[model samples]
Target: MEMVDWNLAVATATRLVRPGPEVSREEARDIVAELRRHAKASEEHVRAFTRMEAANPEDADTPVLVVDRPGWVRANVAGFRELLAPLLGKVEERRASIPGGAVLGAVGGKVTGVEVGMLLSFLASRVLGQYETFAPASRELPGATESGGRLLLVAPNIVHVERELDVDPHDFRMWVCLHEETHRTQFTAVPWLRDHIQMEIQSFLGETEIDPSTLLERLREAAQSLTGAKPEAEEGADAEDEPSGESRGSIVELVQTPAQREILGRLTAVMSLLEGHADYVMDGVGPQVVPSVAEIREKFQKRRATGAGRLDQALRKLLGLDAKLRQYRDGERFVRAVVEEVGMDGFNKVWTSPNTLPTKAEIAKPADWIARVHRKAD
Candidate 1:
């Protein structure tokens, strides 16, 4: 039995997702066309700044898609389904062992689907763009040589954020494209990267030991942890001593075992590198390409720290987006530090192999990564 009704999830998200800013049909088309052009243009700037070219000629031709909120939800649902297939298969195997498991799954699937939909709907408005690394080859645009991945610029979200930030739409769109395009360049330029991340995800899923019986209870604990509500026993403990969920990391970290945490650390490091490197590239390439980049970055940073409202803040904590914000800051710091110590070419050594990539600890201390990778070379 399926644990989530994928179709239901899609329906719920599309029905509940908030509408984007008002725009005429002609205006929307213009926004999309401009975004597509910016995406293509950003690629050249990113490639030039990073000095990392696609390893394969085919990889260079990766598709750039401009999508609306519902379209973004649909694409992500497909990605989540692909990425979670292994874990879902494991759940199925365990369910088959239980006597009433099929019945439970039948009842639970729709509930899970709605919850997934709600989460996606919340995110649908917030994300500006993304590099969908796990995009299925079957979904690749016809005649595309490399089915490696596609870049998605969420048109509605971009328009919403730029208007909210009160920045130049043209510059803001290109700035957003710069960050996302850097991600596409990272994966394409380093042929092994996609496979490396897939292996890590598979490894992490392989280590999952889910129990159908206690799933709800585990989720309850995770929710409590996210909301900063301590159990009754720890209610009197020092608040400062007990770090909040935002500081501790994501719900994923709260639920994992020690071994799984180790794997998570490695994955976190890789993600930080990717996110940080993109931020670095965007800023590095900004002045020449994106005028008013300074105002955009400043406003964007403030907006990230202070979301719309209490409900939005709580959801960001729950979804681990607060941690994502930190990834951009912390990762950018790491990248900046390394580039300062040793020029851009020297920092490029990170993409040489997985072994050269910084560890979780090293992300916090660039000197450690520089010493380990560069000192050895010297």
Candidate 2:
């Protein structure tokens, strides 16, 4: 029997509850043990958090930091709590007794810990029927997103304004949360989306290849450029019409091939649509929910304009999520404007099925989208 370590536990639990198995039995036993240990760890973390919350040494207004900041996890919990409240009375009356929200209410003020334990328990209970261990309503960020079916989120340990996702950020940060939550909701609602996202990622990896020599050349060029002496070194040289022709070439050799780039672009476009739709939906709802939205949005834009390095690295390193971010900003405006003109009922019709989503071109131009919506109205 393999000693269950943390890594093995994550792998084992992940594979056990995952859509498919990607490990061996001996390895799996270790994973199972690790999962239990991790759950205990999570519980400990929660207890620590509780102590942190209780100590009250720090400012109450101090911002909170999360290791795993999965959009769906936060959103689902918030949404479920909201969902659970109103229905609680009726349910209790029907049962004639339900222990006053036993597990749930006891878990209050310690929601995060309870939720972590819930996920671990859920993961372990796969021997039973298919119950969502982590659903749209419950998602978490991982130290690594490579694990299959594992919903993961991560953000900086430091943030401006607030923690716990409540501190205001000109609205953009809130919108980000909303967008992330939207992703969670879609996964939870669609059921197929979670599988689809992972499958697409696997497909992308299956085809992706990184060139060694080209990568080295590109690195050298990038390093050289950092010196910032290109113009002075080539002062007497001919005017360089092409921009970074040499460096681009080097990077090109090292990076994904054209065919692979296309694959990447396609994935980026899909992610963009996902992101854009989330933004759009939030816009539709936020005006009614959070008022300082537009100002917050402007602030968020400024952060991006200033080059959010963390965001950039994340997007660049992972399946070109950078492109997705850009596309989303553009797409949000396109979709929101359309919704305003088209009406909610009209726009809602689009999500009737998967095929109805706006294409890449459509996202680029809202006017075209409006025209299509008009045609639909007709």
Candidate 3:
């Protein structure tokens, strides 16, 4: 039984994400060149303020790509496929273990594919730049390497957002690069980070099971609701339970098993650390290199709080994006608070080993991590 047809997912995503106004080959080339110029300075800025024990493992000499919306969707779909490979394999095995499971498996795969495709369709327009630490399989797809563990700057989205914000275009571009390049430097310089995060994700996935019958039931109910067959009163409870517009407490509500929740807690704490550190590094470089940094940050934060339309806002809520946003704010606060009390060197200790990483509670109260970590040192 096939768990998911990744190719079909990619195709559906590509079709759903409407193509932007076409750019000539020359324009695309120029976009990549311009971003590359900014990237060099951005890298230098991050390095000047931060120190890591290990040398960056990534091919720093590699170029960044400037992709359009469809390209972004295709790349991310490939990434999701690679990322979820093991979990889906387990699902397939579990399905086959059941009596008359083949038909159920096929239905599950198709439904999952469509759901993922639709999610990516909306996300394609929102992301700016990413440092994909996990490399895509080179032998599998022709253009996979371009989308692998390298820097990706989505050109159209960047251009559109910058224009809309009325900020300094050059400065804004550099600000964006600072964030992405910091992430690149993070996984590269910390060496163990990539493997550590991948392992945690795998552990989380291992504990997560997809019950075909339960999934089928949910799909039937959803279909009925969409067709307006369900009464309004029946939908009230579901709407009320829909997370009250996103909060820290609701962050792990989607995970089913206790093991998954435990793994998710660890994963969330680590992400908070990584994302917080990146934000700290980006702002630490400050107004000297990125002169309009404050202005850019202010406008960007406002933009995130409110999306383009009701559909975009709804997607963000449904996708737990607000929860993700809170991570940045929460993490930044934790990092700032910790660094204020213990200096940069003391805060750097968190990156030394996974054991030293913050817990969810520690993330909310930075002093707890500082005291515990430093006490061990003494």
Which candidate leads the pack in TM-score? Answer: 1
Model 3 off-target regions past 4 Å? 21-27, 53-59, 97-100, 137-148, 217-252, 376-378
lDDT tens string, model 3, 256-370? Answer: 4788868878888888887887888888886878888898889988998887876665556555676778788889999999989988888888878898999988999998998
lDDT of 1 by residue, 288-358 (tens): 99889999999998998897987787777777787778788889999999999999999999999999999
Tell me the lDDT of candidate 3. 0.73
The lDDT of model 1 is: 0.85
User: How many residue pairs clash per model?
Assistant: 0, 15, 0
Model 2 segments more than 4 A misplaced = 1-176, 210-254, 308-324, 345-354, 366-378
The 10 consecutive residues of candidate 2 with the worst lDDT sum are 125-134
- Models, CA RMSD each: 2.1, 20.3, 4.1
lDDT of every predicted structure (CA atoms): 0.85, 0.41, 0.73
Estimate TM-scores for all models.
0.94, 0.46, 0.85
Over all chains combined, what TM-score does candidate 3 have?
A: 0.85
Compared with the true structure, model 2 gives a TM-score of 0.46
